[model samples]
Target: MQKPLTDFPTGSVVRIAGIDGGRQARSRMLAMGMTPGCPVTVLAGGPTGCRVRVRGSEVVLCCGLAGKIMAVADDSDEGPRCNCCPGPRARAI
Candidate 1:
């Protein structure tokens, strides 16, 4: 079984897998450099918004927006990874 975006912890480097909403949603994600295959690091998350680090930029996305984005945990232990490394494997939400 594959891991879902919600499986990642507050700070984990992940790769964008899929977007689960409409065109507008997809477009918004794309605008944030969240297109499939892009890497994103979870900064912080709550009921309100999730702070994500993408392409060296930090952005906050609401829960609704975050729910639309699908991501996979990046298991590669490549150096320092991202500023938001939530440690080992995280369970799904």
Candidate 2:
């Protein structure tokens, strides 16, 4: 099942299921490559915001902004893996 991006734990590898927001917000995220089906790893988060690695790049988003992005948790033991990078960087969420 899909849940708000914030619902997932840090280091979880999740696939973007969908997004919720107005045109501008959605466009911004999409343009930044946070589109549906993309795999993102939650790096760190707090009450207000979090940092995520998207498409091998790290990006930060506020809780409100993150709430708009929905994701399906992946079953892989390791966290998100950036194909562009090397080494076993994945961690348990």
Candidate 3:
């Protein structure tokens, strides 16, 4: 089963399952390279907000916005690679 974005703690690597939001919100997130199947790293988070690295870019999302992003925690040893921005090696910190 997938978990909400907020459920992942800092330093967790996860794969996006889907986003639950209106057209505008979805479009904005998609435009920022937050598409399904991409790997993201949770950098830091509070009760209602968090910062994540997506496709080598930092994105800040509030709890309301984050709850809309569903992801499955990924612990594979394979290096992280976002389809949107491939080539760079990603190692868990």
Candidate 4:
């Protein structure tokens, strides 16, 4: 089922469904690799914003930006397993 980005729980892997915002916002998101169909995993969330793991990169997104991203929880077992390497740490805001 589809849901807002803010509703997604931390650590939940999801696929970008669509964006809901004006052209400028969409363009910015696109530049950041948040285009529709992209896979993203919610890492943390809080008052300021949320952090998401996308394509092995950890990106911190503000609530406004996060709100524009629409995604569906990925319940598939066919994707590659994550290799949680020791690198940048992620914490709930």
Candidate 5:
């Protein structure tokens, strides 16, 4: 179920499961609010990088950084609510 963040498509809602990189990468992501269990919505992506919304803030990550982020589909009943997400079943992916 876990996959690199870059594997997800636009509008997909997923949760951060872990980081695949070293301490520095993890620390940087953490400071950006990309911690385990944090919800992320893929706003847009390509081979180079992607944009995501985390806890209401938008953050851009290069492919290398995004590849270091392990994520899984968010299947909770409540999911993570946001103006963009709207509801549990509103995900575009």
Candidate 6:
């Protein structure tokens, strides 16, 4: 059920499965705290780019970069879920 980040609608919560790109792309994303298995929420999107919340920060990514991020919908009903980068946290914008 993996889909590109750009493919997910705004307000969707998904878990990053993998990144499809070169080493540089992977490294940049990792440094931005977008590691595999981490939860990400789509904040807003348009034709050029989109904003997403991950690792306690909101990031704006262009379509190219966002398209490289593969994530799966987090539809699990399990309570209090946590993962590699810790579950979503609340932070003031």
lDDT at 4, model 5? 89
Candidate 5 local accuracy as lDDT? 0.80
Q: What TM-score does prediction 5 earn?
A: 0.80
Candidate RMSDs in order: 7.4, 5.1, 3.9, 6.8, 4.8, 4.2
Superior candidate under TM-score, 1 versus 5: 5
Point out where model 6 deviates above 4 Å.
76-82, 85-93
Write candidate 3's Cα lDDT for 23-68 as tens digits.
9878987898878767888999656977999877899998988888
Model 4: lDDT to the true structure: 0.71
Better of 2 and 3 by lDDT: 3
Model 3 local distance difference test score: 0.76
Among all windows of ten consecutive residues in candidate 4, which has the lowest summed lDDT? 84-93
Candidate 1 lDDT over residue span 4-66, tens digit each: 455567977777777888999889888876666567778886556688888778888877888
Q: Rate the local accuracy (lDDT) of all candidates.
A: 0.67, 0.73, 0.76, 0.71, 0.80, 0.77
lDDT per residue (tens digit) for residues 1-93 in model 4: 666788888888777778889999899988876766667888896546789877667899898988888777565433222233232322122
Q: Candidates 3 and 5: which is better by TM-score?
A: 5
What's the true lDDT of residue 71 in model 5?
83
Q: What is the lDDT of residue 53 in candidate 1?
A: 81
Model 2 alpha-carbon drift over 4 Å, by segment = 76-93
Q: How well is each residue in 12-72 modelled by candidate 6, as lDDT tens digits?
A: 8887778999999999999998887677889996557779998779999999999998887
The stretch of ten residues in a row with the least summed lDDT in candidate 6 is: 84-93
Q: Compute each candidate's TM-score over C-alphas.
A: 0.71, 0.76, 0.78, 0.75, 0.80, 0.80
Rank the candidate models, highest lDDT first: 5, 6, 3, 2, 4, 1
lDDT for 45 (candidate 4): 68
Clashes of each: 1, 0, 0, 0, 0, 0
Error of 3 at 24 (Å): 1.2
Best by lDDT: 5
Model 2, 27-80: lDDT tens digits are 989988877656778998655777998877889999888988877775543323
lDDT score for residue 61 of model 6: 97
